[model samples]
Target: MRQYSIADLESRLAPSPRMPVLFVGHGNPMHAISDNAFTREWSRIGADLPEAQAIVVISAHWLTPGSTHITDAPRNRVIYDFGGFPDALSRVPYPSEGDPVVARAIRQQFLDYEAQLDAQWGLDHGTWSVLVHLAPEPTVPVLQISLDYAMPLPELHATFARLRALRDRGVLFIGSGNIVHALGRARWEPHAQAWDWAVEFDRVTGDALRERRVDQLLDPFRTWDTARIAVPTDDHYRPMVAAMSLLDPDEDLSFFNEQIDMGSIGMRSFMTA
Candidate 1:
């Protein structure tokens, strides 16, 4: 396979606007409402990033059994997907308008079956929690792309590749989920340190991401036991695969918020232009 540069990737869809692609490792919902380092970084990215016509977030929260769906609400309301959080967290509304044109562009990008435009779906925790920090006002049009868990691996990867061209369409694609999300072993206390296995798993993932050996990520069991402990489910880890697919060989890579929190959640994020 040919390794394309950022320039080459944009040239394919030249004359269209181009923007950076981001994979944000959102650890906890509290990060959204808090004024901490992580949220500060997110807000900084928002201020620094170019004026985006639309933002398409592929969140781990909205999982589909068979096919993918894109949120198409003209004015999307926040849907508090998680429970047990404070009422203020649930009441937080991220009212980012939807773009039908961009949504259509996303659907049309597919070579196979088209992605469906979902009117019912709203901003889930995986998406809004991060976006609220990134785009506080969120006046920019925001569309969400749901994960099709039942889709075959090769096919899902192919879909991610197709989504890369969206950058040139003035759309910033964001993958929202942690690299290591082991809620079962998470500590409730703030400033909790990461476990040894969590550190190892995060390091391995970062290495794979930097080396462009993303396929190795699909099968972690043969590589390290720590990875098995890190990723018991695909929801969190799968977003990274999509992020990897967007990588351009010649583009500069940037990472931020490299801290692992609550013992298991790896708050490691990266980006490429």
Candidate 2:
């Protein structure tokens, strides 16, 4: 990939119109390098997208309290933030540059919300795994916003409301996490049966989104039947809530790769206008 200075990159990105927001159920780390159905769908999603100014990813793996972290280095590294993967997976690199100017813009925009620039945090599997399929060339500048683990659902929703403006500026805000993630239930069984709880939870969640019921969608733990099993931890599902809260009612929504993975986990990938 051709390396560009942060200034050069930001200058090129500033004038474009905002890209759509995506909520991707990025399942396992192995999907990063594998040529599977989900990977093909991700590639198709990228192929269909309009050019973006920059990408702000709210990945499931990086969570913090009150603060959002943005990568500001000129050359960002690929984080092998997973274990027990093949050595070739570790060797895979997506050397996308980071734009400090854009990072600063995000920081200033969320000044009251306490945004911080991190030099050390690189692209985790929640990021590169999906991006490797989304933008295989790795030419687009990328920044990641951390989930405030301590905040309530409403607070996170409000934060996303402030972030809605970035959509018009050509930045693609992506929330990458599974809607039905039960770590204990996920298995490699080729013919595994879909757990009833997982099915019910994913269906209810999808229905709520389709109905534009933001409140119901935000409070999944209360409204959904399988919150405990589906969302074993809030870290993986909160990012989706953050992204969904930013969507406009009039925005066009499309669900791609709408299926269950490992029998019970939803592998749905969706985009909003």
Candidate 3:
């Protein structure tokens, strides 16, 4: 396949430096409390971040149909969305405030559509698992937007691009999901050998991101057989599109924890500078 380069994005970068978008590949929920390299990197990144107005996250765990919504609660209750995990994982706390200001701004931005204000919704495992390490004592207000695959392909990409502007305003946009996540085929061992298909899909994903090839990403399965196995369902993959949409061609992209955790899940992550 033909490749695009940073020169392509550099030409498209805005005059002002945009806020960095961090795409975190949050694999096992156990990492939330563990002091692994992934969590350590999260801690380092959090310390280096610019002061932000509010945080906006797109998590694989949050799914809704037809409409998109953002959390609007004052203090969100951590949602133990996963099953069969140890009871200790559920007891973890992430008592962060929700920003009504950013929530209203998002509603106004998508003014044409009635974006729902969700009070019942709160931080899911996708968000908290990483946030526990990224921002242990996050004083910054946080909000989450549900992923709606029902939107037309064109509209889905366009909306994500709109949110990219939030970076200039000091609003952090985080996408928390793995590059390759096939739970049914995962190896429970930390050092288990990665499946060949998982490794292939993960490499393609990183190459596509560095080149800003959204077309290949949106329809990854066309070329790579591993794509189908990697993304049997796209709940974990779509957030990547939304997160990478805002990245300018010229800005630097850095990746950390560039390895697969389980045999089936690639825990590769990147940030757009």
Model 3 score (lDDT):
0.81
Model 3 over residues 23-129: C-alpha lDDT tens digits?
99999999998898888988998889877767788999998879889997878889998789888988999999986556766665665777888889999999999
Candidate 3 — which residues are off by over 4 angstroms?
Answer: 1-17, 152-154
Per residue, candidate 1 scores C-alpha lDDT tens digits across 1-273 of 233455553443334556888999988888778898999999888888887767888898989878899887778878888778888897787877986656666776775776888989988888889988888887578888888998755567768888776777677889998889898999879788888899999998788777776567766667768877898887887777777677676677788998898998999999874
| Candidate with the greatest TM-score versus the true structure | 2
Write candidate 2's Cα lDDT for 1-273 as tens digits: 344465754565566665788999999888887998999989988888898878889998998777778888777788888788789889988889887777776776574877788878878888888998898885668888888898888888887678787777778888999888887787678857778888888888887778888888777778876888888888888888878877887877878877778876777777884
Q: Is 1 or 2 the stronger prediction by lDDT?
A: 2
For all candidates in order, the CA lDDT equals 0.80, 0.81, 0.81
Q: Over all chains combined, what TM-score does candidate 3 have?
A: 0.90
